[model samples]
Target: MVQDAASGDVVAAGTSGEKKPGFFARIVIFFRQVIAELRKVVTPTRSELLKFTAVVLGFVVVMMALVYGLDYLFSWVTTVVFGVPA
Candidate 1:
């Protein structure tokens, strides 16, 4: 017996006499909700798009450099431990 927090109304989980919507009715409801959500989307301007792209590319480049340095350091450590000739 769950109750709505705002309205203090008892939430009916298929217990009430009301019947759930049919398959097609649910499909219509789904599209309505999707359209409502799509309306909230904001398209970035050209300047904002360029800034976002530059930030993402800069982050990727920094990550690649970090990974390369770590790989080189680990390879050197492993070589020293196993006495592998480099």
Candidate 2:
């Protein structure tokens, strides 16, 4: 018998003594737990969702500008190293 870490239940494993739940039992238990958890989720209001979207978009734009600036700097360095064509 193996003791569960959180609940301290005496769980028995198969002959191998690995203490894992069987396949179908695990799937059913997983879905049951998922449904129980989904019942507790609190979705944000429309205004809050819009605010989050705006923040994400602003962050993405700033990252893009930073990447473009770095690309231009590297290109300038490479051009200078190889010298202007004419």
Candidate 3:
């Protein structure tokens, strides 16, 4: 729905019978939109990038340690129950 900004009335952008833009026109519009969006992007500083990378790596290491501990505990329990080690 399209709105009449000053009148505060809702309106359709186009009628159902109205033809849409052709393929080349659509491609041009797509690239225009992509460029507009890319213009809005902000790059992080080197320090901020380093901090983010370190935070991600630290999280991964903590997850690995937790998984290893749980796996070892389960393996020990299994060996005791089966009277055999893999």
lDDT of each: 0.88, 0.88, 0.86
Clashes of each: 0, 0, 0
What tens digits encode model 1's per-residue C-alpha lDDT throughout 1-86? 44556788998756654667889998998899899999999999999999999999999999999999999999999888898665
The digit string of per-residue lDDT tens for model 2 on 1-86 reads 56666787877665345657789988998899899999999999999999999999999999999999999999999898998888
Per-prediction RMSD in angstroms?
A: 3.7, 4.2, 3.6
Off by over 4 Å in 2: 1-21
Overall local distance difference test of candidate 2:
0.88
Best candidate according to TM-score: 1
In candidate 2, the residue pairs with backbone N, CA or C atoms under 3 Å apart (3 or more residues apart, or in different chains) clash, namely none
lDDT value, residue 73 of candidate 1: 99
Candidate ranking under TM-score, highest first, comes to 1, 2, 3
Deviation (Å) of 35 in candidate 2: 0.9
TM-score of each: 0.78, 0.72, 0.70
The TM-score of candidate 1 is 0.78
lDDT of 3 by residue, 1-86 (tens): 54566688876767434566789987998899899999999999999999999999999999999999999999999888897844
